[model samples]
Target: MSAFNLETCARSNILALEPYRCARDDYKDDGTNILLDANENAYGPSLTTAAASSASSATTSSGPEIDFLGLHRYPDPHQRGLKRLLCNLRNTHHHTDKKITPDNLFVGVGSDEAIDSLMRCFCVPGRDRILVCPPTYGMYSVSAQVNDVGLVKIPLLPAPSFALDVANIKQALSNEPNIKLAYLCSPGNPTGAPLAKEDIRQLLEHPTWNGVVIVDEAYIDFSPEGSSLAEWVAEWPNLAIMQTSSKGFGMAGIRLGSLFASAPIARLLNSMKSPYNITSPTSALAMYAFSPDGLAVMHANREKIVAQRERLIRELPKIKGIGRLRGGIESNFLLYELLNKVGQPDNVTALAVYERLAENRGVVVRFRGKEHGCLGCLRITVGTETEVTRFLESVGETLAEVNGHDIVVYSDEEKREVEANAVIS
Candidate 1:
């Protein structure tokens, strides 16, 4: 008994920090099937091939609708075709040689793997740390903590306008030389807002900072055309831009995330990663997704989602207890606060509404009130036209019941855990 201590066995930081939980982990009630939890695409992939093949069954008479020849064999260790498409689409080419080769990119299972890999490759577990802009993405901090790497959290400036403080970040970077990775989520999770190009440039060009600046453009397609810093990575060797097929391409299940960086870093990540990380089916899907016809479907889906997001912004404010929206309407989601009769942000009221809507109404959105700068907030994904309408109606009903009523007493640890869950994957 005297020799048994879990705390002594595990690292101190690991014991102190909580593990990351996916949405499906905690909430598995019947109505929670309507999942907007993990910021997944409600609209499925640029399913041009799938559609043209058949609607009747998963398999076709000719063969399976999906490519299944190499089910027994290991998949591509280097997902070259996927990388080539991503590189071509983003136009990450050198001035002299206009071809963006597969060597310039590394594919991850999702952006989650890319994030974890960055920490692993750069930060030495107990000694080093990473910088994160909070009320942004949770995965950066979660990934750091998992690797036993410390975190320097500089939260984005508060709501209505959750902009980055470039000056503050630069100072932090200068002071914290141990910081090797800085994570910035453009069109940030829980906010749907993008960081300014000027602000990012300032951080990149900072003299004191030699660390990698990760501009996560997971939601970039929903944003303006020139907003992405992906192409600039060729010049800025220290810059690594992460984009996903999940968000804009509408293929969350495929789990193909693109990390475009300098040749050295890409090679380093490739070296560190497991051989055959991507499966054959995912590769086949990626092929169709990046093909000309598939891209058109994605473009069409993006346009529709953009329109729906705009409609949500317009209508959400009209519902009682749903106060002024907090984030920019750049991505396919809206971050807005739940209000009291007095019109201030109220977490108790917010959580109650969230719980009620999920338990009773079958509409599941993210309770972002726990996130910094998103007080009393809920992050609703931009679903199809009808789905958004259903969410709006559900919120209206739930608001009427839950508003101005605060009963449950949450422990301090419980509150922190709830807030901590605000981190997107």
Candidate 2:
């Protein structure tokens, strides 16, 4: 096996590029404000105490005082405090012997920024390529297109499991040395299953593939315990993991995404990122999210989501036109087939049901009929108890309206068979 070399992996021009420097780079904001440098509003933010107080309860702060007044000032460019809190959070969650430090972390606008940054940092436009498994996240391909970077697609091993094609990925890596990054979506989007750890390990331990393997763990917290590969970053310098506060922390509005990588890779991303990319409000909310109280709420909410997911598993199949649930039940959403009269996956019926539910009944769910191996599929997120009930009712009504028949509740034996087939298929 060859040693992982950042020099070989990164673009030649990026290695030589000098990052843009701002006034904050010269003098760090340490709260001693005799500030007349950045041309920020000295009068403070144009917000009332009443307005701030009303929204203060949304954060995990002990008191009602939010730092909304400081919005005029530029946020921390380095995000020192937030990174420290994130490091602590991951260390505690993963229980790694080697603790992560601020240097090993990169905070971006969202996972999208990190995703694009990784491409820009390594792949040369039009010359280098990245590998992705289909029936996966779309942003990877979108980012690749936006960056003008080439892409090589290896579709996930057919439906139901959607596991990574590890052998083929390694083969691609070996054959195409220009492929600098491979994006793996665990608890995959559209396909709720996770890639096996040993499968990922095979790619990481490949003798010739020196490019970075990025694991997007956007839904890891929703998965079973010990499912995250974050702790392994300490061991593999070429490994980078993308996590977001959107799914588990319930802070999607914050637009904060994290990248856990070796210190060098983290530092590289930090250098290239726009200064003040993360705003003050986003930082404050994220900090509170990491607080003890915030964590408790997150966990409690997660349990509710998991329970609701189980409810979805049990209830969705009982509906007349809903076929076997595809993919593993590790993420917040489920992907299942929309069956026709003959009980086979049918896209026409799926589209009719999806459109009717949204346009007529005011219930919205994604119609994923076009994605690889996801024929006649609808990706439904597990909502609150009330929301789930509404969805179930709406879906039944929509299916009956589309099919022009009364909804038939499946027998217990039929439901069991469908569920069992979902598990094994």
- Give each model a TM-score: 0.78, 0.93
- Candidate 1 displacement at residue 270 in angstroms: 0.5
lDDT at 389, model 1: 83
- Screening candidate 1 with a backbone cut-off below 3 angstroms (N, C-alpha, C), the clashing residue pairs are 138-423, 187-193, 187-194
Q: What are the RMSDs of all candidates, in order? A: 14.3, 3.0
Ten-residue region with minimum lDDT total, candidate 1: 1-10
Over 339-398, each residue of candidate 2 has an lDDT whose tens digit, in order, gives 887778989999999999999988899999999999999999999999999999999878
- Per-residue lDDT tens digits of candidate 1, residues 29-109? 243366565553444333555563463144435333332333433455666667878877877342223444677798989
Best-performing candidate as measured by lDDT: 2
lDDT of each: 0.75, 0.85
The regions of model 1 sitting more than 4 angstroms off are 1-67, 92-99, 404-425
Q: How high is the lDDT of residue 226 in model 2?
A: 69
How does model 2 fare in lDDT? Answer: 0.85
